[model samples]
Target: MPEVWERGADDEFAGRADDGSYDATARVVDARGVDDEQRVEAALRPKRLADFPGQPRVRDQLSLVLEAARRRDAVPDHILLSGPPGLGKTTLAMIVAAELERPIRVTSGPAIQHAGDLAAILSSLAEGEVLFLDEIHRMARPAEEMLYLAMEDFRVDVIVGKGPGATAIPLELPPFTVVGATTRAGLLPAPLRDRFGFTGHLDFYSSDDLAAILVRSARLLGVEALDDGIAEIAGRSRGTPRIANRLLRRVRDWSQVHGRGVVDLEAAHEALALFDVDVRGLDRLDRGVLELLCTRFGGGPVGLSTLAVAVGEEPDTVETVAEPYLVREGFMVRTPRGRAATALAWQHLGLTAPMDAPGAGAPQLPLDGEGRFS
Candidate 1:
């Protein structure tokens, strides 16, 4: 049986704070504390499931989850939201709290470096509360282990004294839902991953979805935008709502400063071009990688580090920022040898591929009679 302790209630948020007293519950009430730009970003975030654009499957599934919990009058099960950044994982977590009418405690995995840190937060959760843990994969190992038991049994053991003479005092917690968001789901341990009753994987939005998002953002920001303008910006938004909104704002600036105070097609094109975003959503850094591969590296079987050096960026940035979209759009390939350019990349850069270039419509080679490479 789980031990029950009636310690006085204290709410705790997972984000960093330097305070000894845990009496006050930390809340991400709004975007008020952040800079003006982030405040605007928050204002543009959709408040409900209906308003959020793209990721239909995730939306529908999350709707059912929230609806089922509502029908039962019980706290929703722990949910794991996995996706690339800027695809609305955090937004969806906030929306979940709104739809449930629950106060949310927001924090990130990196903030909880010790088991005690996680335990302190877990022990303070109010009944039926929602806890949004962002970048959950970055949490420390001991903290993660502590979280597993907490998620399963709603209890955490408070350790006292040194390891040899330590005693664990079990503390029972109220029923609360953890809404964890992670950019890299693969990094989560199997035990932690299995604890979540629901999981949502958000993919990049389509051009149409991005356009709709931009239109919604424009209305909220009071920007006059033509449909063609919205469509143009969306096509170059890198298939992300965050990027779409950012591009829309940039275009709005351009329209106000240079052209009429309206986001027209010309304004969208000129603004994006000035920012080095091409029509297909490839930015200067993206094109630099492609150009380096096709022109300098001869279509590249080059290592990521080598490529990054050539482009004057960190290897992680090259891999995480540029490579995913490039690979997704068929512009590049992660070969066993290394990163290589596809024929599409050459064409996109307005360059013809050499006859012997990788992915340049090469014919299949004949196999020997012994089934060996010819």
Candidate 2:
């Protein structure tokens, strides 16, 4: 008989602080969600893969995997989901379980600090259960190694007692599927990465896809939203469904408080303006980084640490959160030396890029053997 254990709640949405004030500068990569946000996101999430809006490629691929496993009357192969934050990785994990008609156990890498921690979870899983591991790249080394064995062989070797007198006890686990989610797939070791049979990389949502997501979310939230208002919010959603839904809620609040309880283009613009999100989806921290690079640094290559300090943010925050979107939008560039603002960045800030600016001149030489853009 499998032992019962508590399943950790999935963290998805970003929300207000303890003081009830929304944090516009929170790291998009962080998965910790406030209670209100978590509840609302759970309700907003699509229960099955067919209902999932965006990422058509991933949705189709996952459908095949689950359907084949169902026909075979066996657990599906271990699945890996990799991409930037807010791209529905967690939601996909839930959909996998739903499609398979199996119970899911949710936990994160940081929660499993020791091999025993992982062994316990594996031993407790019911046959054909889905174990959803969030942030799999951050799992402890020992735990990760244990996971490699468990994922491949459906067993864990539990070590008892101290180093010298320790005895290895092989614990056979029920056949189950592991669905791992990570924002940094590259950080995963080759051995562990190879254990997963199917890997799906989710891309940022298109504006049209985002608009479609907003329409669904608006209906679900019972917000009376106009088409133009939904389009306005989607355009400023930074290619993320999470941000789109969040912005929609903010617009709803603005409409109720300021307008006549109708989410229109005016309400969206006013709410987004109040929240410091510009027309280009650049937020306060994003614009701060651009402004510092173009004006303070003369648009030259500055070290990432220096650029982050200038913007009053952590290097990881600047790199993982703001930099991806900025570079994707062509407003910034990552050079061999460091970070540089592009001409578009300068233009967006209503400034001109100098001739010798990092991106304005000829291409920069590669650092070492790597490409110009590290």
Candidate 3:
């Protein structure tokens, strides 16, 4: 949760830069078209629950919950959505409001820095409004306490004065739903976690699901795309809809400039190669980690700090941004000792595993006579 405050029209709020102004959202600021190439991700976001693909379990469960609440003509219960970034937690929050036909107030946990800030937002809520709190785990401790009381009792106590003269004033709140999203749900206290009536965890999308998402997004963006092209992009999307959509736009650029103005297999491959994303969906940093582990450290039991230093990245960035996916994809493994690259990782990087490597007996992908993975 970063404290990026920029005001927008009415209830809308945008993130700001250090100088207190809206900064253009881009992957890089270089003049090499990276800035323009970074599409506005929100444009492809699904507005309704049905339009959102993947996470079948969560979607089905959430649909029933919302329908039941609608039938009762009441506000839905508080919900906690837990998952990694770009998996559509925020989209689901908005869908909750859409399904209930209620207006939603958008704010993040970092915005509520004090008990008073939480009080103001809670107290000002209209009955049945949906309040979305992104990155809920990063909320201030004092605010967390106030939130517990508010959620359970629909009331908050305002403390006035100082020292022994402190007086508590009770304020009643209208019944409303708090839709909280967090990437690190384990960090939430048990007391706060128990307050949510329903909890949903989002998981990464499958390649088939990603393909379907890309097709739908192509229609929304009015880009002509072939099925093979969609599949290619989906295969390299790292199982995230956000990345899939972003790659689609870049592919569209290559199609228009280098070839026919349609996203075909050739356009997809050319655009992806230009971006340096490998066939297994591993980007430069991802391959860098694997390469260093296999080559520099002899298939490593290397420490995370040493590995991060070798890659010129912060330990936290490597842990949160890269390690989870690598571990999930079976390219890397974490042990009590340290980090180690799997035999699959070595093969993926087009290198042979050393005889002494950990998990040297791991199964290898079937290969052609020319040494290409089949």
Candidate 4:
């Protein structure tokens, strides 16, 4: 977790010139017409469980758990939501609050540094409040230990003072729910993982679910979309509602510029192609990473650092964006040694598969791919 101190929304992004600070959220900074696209998408994000598409079984299971908790007037058990990015983990956190009719206080792991920092946030929680801790696995070690006791005993032991005079102050915290979301659940300590009442693993959405999400999002955006266009977009969305909404927004842009009245199949296809996304939906950068790994590293049992250097990208970016989908699509595998791009890598990239490949496997989309809406 990166500790980026909170600043005003109107704060200008401190460019790379000053202390090499990079604001990843710069794209969301106040701008003109282009920024509106980003803001509108935020408005389109689902606020309720019923509106959040995909991962239906988890939602149903969660609903029962929350309802049961609310019936007893208790904070619902701590939930751990783990998945790849853009899988609506945050949205589900909000939905949990909405269903329980409780207030939600949102913060990330990096935001809490020292034990005192954790104490500040924990002490302020109202009874039955939902303390949404996004990326909980990335919390600092001291804070994480504090959280363990808080989750386990409904109390936080805060250390006051320093050195020889330091004293532990045990504070009674609210009986609140901790909805922790993480892209890398494996990084969480075993003690932390065990503390959660329910561990929900969010998986990729299927084409049909993605399509339904597209329909819902398009309705929100006031964009008329044909059924074929919806399906095509869904298929190419990389199985994320956020990406589906992004593709739709881009199509709307192209439609306005090309004099197309609404998003039809042709407009959608053209818009995606212009953005360097293919029919099977691998984007240019995605293919770039895989191609380098396959051809340069000879299908790679390559270490992540070596691969990152090969592709001229940060190890984290390679692991996060380019790697997860490739792994899930069976284009890569995470061995004990390193990452190995698979036979599907060759097939997807139009290369010949080796006669005996180690990582050759079928792509079975996870349970989240099953049609929940149907």
Model 2 error, position 216 (Å)? 0.8
TM-score of each: 0.86, 0.85, 0.86, 0.81
Q: Going through the candidates in order, what is the number of backbone clashes in each? A: 0, 0, 0, 0
How far is each candidate from the true structure, as Cα RMSD in Å?
12.2, 10.3, 8.0, 7.2
For candidate 4, write residues 1-374 as lDDT tens digits: 34354444666653333565765654444468768766785778787777777798898888888889979888889999999888889989988988888999999998888878888988999998999999898899999998999998989877778899999878998799999999999999999999999989998888889988888888888888899889888888888887888888889888889846588899888999999887667887788888987898888788999988888889999987888777767678898878887786887788976745564554444443332333
lDDT of 3 at 330: 79
Worst 10 residues of 1 by lDDT: 1-10
Candidate 2: pairs in clash? none
Model 2 alpha-carbon miss at residue 226, Å:
0.9
User: What tens-digit string does per-residue lDDT give for candidate 2 at 106-198?
Assistant: 999999998878888888899999999999999999999898888888888988898899999998988999999999999999999999999
- Candidate 1 lDDT, tens digit per residue, 93-158? 999999999999999999999999999898888999999999999999999999998999999999
- Where is model 3 poorest over a 10-residue stretch in terms of lDDT? 21-30
Q: Which lDDT value does model 1 have at 67?
A: 99
How many Å off is the CA of 287 in candidate 3? 0.8
Off by over 4 Å in 3: 1-40, 363-374
lDDT of 3 at 159: 95
